[model samples]
Target: MLLTVSGPPGSGKSTAAAALATALDYEHVSGGDVFRELAEERGMSLGEFNALAEEDDTIDRDLDRRLREISETRDEVVLESRLSGWMAAEHADLRIWLDAPLDVRAERIAAREEKPVEQAREETVTRAESEALRYREYYGIEIDDLSIYDAVLNTARWGPAETTELLVALAESYDPQTDEGTFPVSGVRYEF
Candidate 1:
């Protein structure tokens, strides 16, 4: 069973994915970390890496192929990425969308990157815009769409462990044969 977790930056997608994967004895794959490592190896910034991705279809295709192959072999796998839902497609047994408020995300990113809140907020907005545009231009995908997901979760009200537990429960209760599913939100339901 492949579980694909996606969300905007600092939304706790990676944290929840790791914890859920560990609890379920699944292999965890983080696309953002992979891209960051690639960027470092190439001595380029994330913006430059994203520009390269826009120009190079091979990079995205290769990663998608590798992820699909992994899904084929692994019984339990947790795929954490902004575009994993689109890339993994049929390979993912359940697609999860994790979200948090903009202010909360900005704070998280600032703390994680050791940057000022103002700078982190600017960078987050820039990166999110670049990612959204790049993904659409390169793969014709909109990362914010939730219709493709089995469960949509908000992490602003819950920590990593609690969010992971909720995801695991949802995964266990999911019936691939049925269209019914559960979406965990803090207060309101988003149409997308």
Candidate 2:
């Protein structure tokens, strides 16, 4: 099964995806990790790299293309990225979108990065806006649109354990062989 987990920065997507992968014994690929690695290689901070991305689309396209290739060629892998769900929408068996309030996400970022909450909040907002604009300009994808996701979870309301458990259960029950276009499980909806 190919599962794509996507959310805004600090939405706990990587945590949830990693947990789900461990529980299911599946390989996990994280686009953010890859992006971060690239930034580190160039000795640039994430915000600086993001600004560079505005002037040059190659960086985003390169990472996104790699993600698409992985999603199309791999199975039993959880693909994690902001646009992973959208890029892999046609190939992914399950697409999940995790959501949390901006303030909650900002707090998480602050804690993770060991920065002040206000600074983290500002950086997060700037990065999000930059990504949204670039995504639209380059791929005609609106990052705000979550209609492509098969399942939507509010990370703020549901803790990591609860969210991971729900995803694991969903994965355990999915059957592709006897399936229609919709999810195999009943009561599942593509929600924003």
- Tens digit per residue, CA lDDT, model 2, 167-186: 88777777766543434545
Q: What is the Cα-based TM-score of model 1?
A: 0.85
The alpha-carbon root-mean-square deviation between model 2 and the true structure, to one decimal in Å, is 2.0
RMSD of each: 3.6, 2.0
The residue ranges of model 2 lying beyond 4 angstroms of the native Cα positions read: 180-187, 190-192
| Shift in Å, residue 101, candidate 2 | 0.3
Best by TM-score: 2
Best by lDDT: 2
Model 1: per-residue Cα lDDT at residue 132:
82
lDDT of each: 0.80, 0.90
Total clashing pairs for each candidate: 1, 0
lDDT of 1 by residue, 1-192 (tens): 788988999999999999989988988999888888888999998778777877787777666677667666776789988888877886787888999988999999999988899888888898888778877876788877788876787899888878887888877766555633444532233332
What TM-score against the true fold does each predicted structure earn? 0.85, 0.95
